[model samples]
Target: MGLPGEMRVVEISGPGGPEVLVPAVRKVPQPAAGEILIRVRAAGVNRPDLLQRAGSYAPPPGASDLPGLEAAGEVAAVGAGVSRWKVGDEVCALLPGGGYAEYVVTPADHALPVPEPLGMIEAAGLCETFFTVWSNVFERGRLTAGESLLIHGGSSGIGTTAIQIARARGVRVFVTAGTEAKCHACLELGAEMAINHREADFVAAVKDATGGRGVDVILDMVGGDYLPRDVRALAPDGRLVMIAHQKGAEVSMNFSLVMVKRLTITGSTLRPQSVEAKARIAEGLFREVWPLLDTGRIAPVIAESYPLEQAAEAHARLESGQVAGKIILEVA
Candidate 1:
């Protein structure tokens, strides 16, 4: 199929709230060498998109100002030297930006073939959270079989994926969510225990669930006070991987506990990383996670979806803190 001369996209009209996301038409983007132009069928709404809309996070240099970070679609065009994909191949990809458009260009290596059982809509929500969880929870946190993990925000996309993937690998999974319903959802996704943070103290709950040994790994998004609590929740030689600071960045924690526990604390932001680094992550995901997806051992959990023109509403829903899984924007 031939490409269009222009495509519709959701642009950040100004830095503010979800209402700032407005629909606009732009000239179709051409992929440079090593990139491919995708005809976007759907896009995933992420917390970073909200941060970008609020002017707290900015796209990296040379990336699109559009907010979406993941998309699923068919290849429409390929740039020179891009041999991995051609017209009509269906794929889902982790994008630097610009997924809110009807068409997007990304490094060919960032795109992966959609799992056999998933359609474009569900596949659309896979890239961002899956990549983050795989890179942080498994690679950085070093969670392995026979170990245990504590996941904050357990009903969100990242939490759900981590829960299933870790469980599939024989790792015990514990999670904390904002509501009882969300907690139950996490448990249904193979978590060994799910604590409702609004009603229970997660640190206490995790300690009790682990018989006071504490967990071996923690995937934390809420920083601030959580930093100290997370420290208290880890066992000796444990790892705490911080991905976001929804609470706040600054914190006061006991250095003595960190030293005594021999814990490791680390984090990373995916969009700003080099193409080679992301390609390495993509390779790992394809080799390890994709087979699990194909076998139905792991999957994307879609909470809701909206039309491309209603991108603002999708963002609003994501910001509402009521969604239990991923939110998608249907473009095609």
Candidate 2:
């Protein structure tokens, strides 16, 4: 595809609060080799998006500085050496950065065909949460059938996705939420146990639910003080995958627990991953996970959708930490 002269995009002029996000018309990006140009219809606002805006998370070198990470749109054009997708394909993609725009370019390998039942809003909501869960919890953590998985922040996008994925695979899921209502919502989504973190110790509740066996895997986004409790909640030979440290990153924890239990700890970020790595993930999802999506075994849970221009308001809602599922930005 040939280059475009200009585009409309949401730009973060500086590191600051949500007020810093501005919608502006800029030069439209051209699709390079192995890339495709998408006329984005919707974009997903994720926790990392906020972190990037706050200056704590920076896009890797050569990636776009724009804040959005996941998007669903129709392909406008395809670059040289790309054959799998062509112009007019309705696709959703996991982008490293630069998704908050009317038109954005992504590696063709990262563009996935949207499941027929999912609309643009739902498709846009898929990438970040699902990618994070599939990579960290399922792939790295090696969560298996009949095993127990505990996810912190059950009401948010990642938590909701993890709960559903684990449940679909026949694993018993336990989640922690800030309120009784959130806990109830997690149970409604098929979680075996939903603990109110504000009122109960998740360690005790999970231990009780598992009959002292502890959980086999944990998807923890809250770092800092939760680290010790997470280790305490894990079973022998368990895995704990840390995706973020919303409270704080650094913490002091005992080494004896890890050594004695033989727990595995690892994590990966989608944005900085190479094209080949993302392609592998896309392939794995298409073969193993997409069928589940089409069969209605797993679905995107969208809590709200805001017009692309009201992104600031969307950010405010996400910052409140009260959303029940994924928040979306409708670009069209």
Q: TM-scores across all candidates? A: 0.99, 0.97
By summed lDDT, which 10 consecutive residues of candidate 1 come out lowest? 1-10
> What's the lDDT for all of these models?
0.93, 0.89
Error of 1 at 135 (Å): 0.5
Please identify model 2 stretches exceeding 4 Å from their true place. 1-4
Runs of candidate 1 exceeding 4 Å displacement: none
| Model 2 deviation from native, Cα RMSD in Å | 1.4
Error of 2 at 41 (Å): 0.5
| Model 1 lDDT, residue 159, Cα | 90
Q: Compared with the true structure, what per-residue lDDT tens digits does model 1 show for residues 104-182? A: 9999999999999999999999999999999999999989999999999999998988998999999999999998899
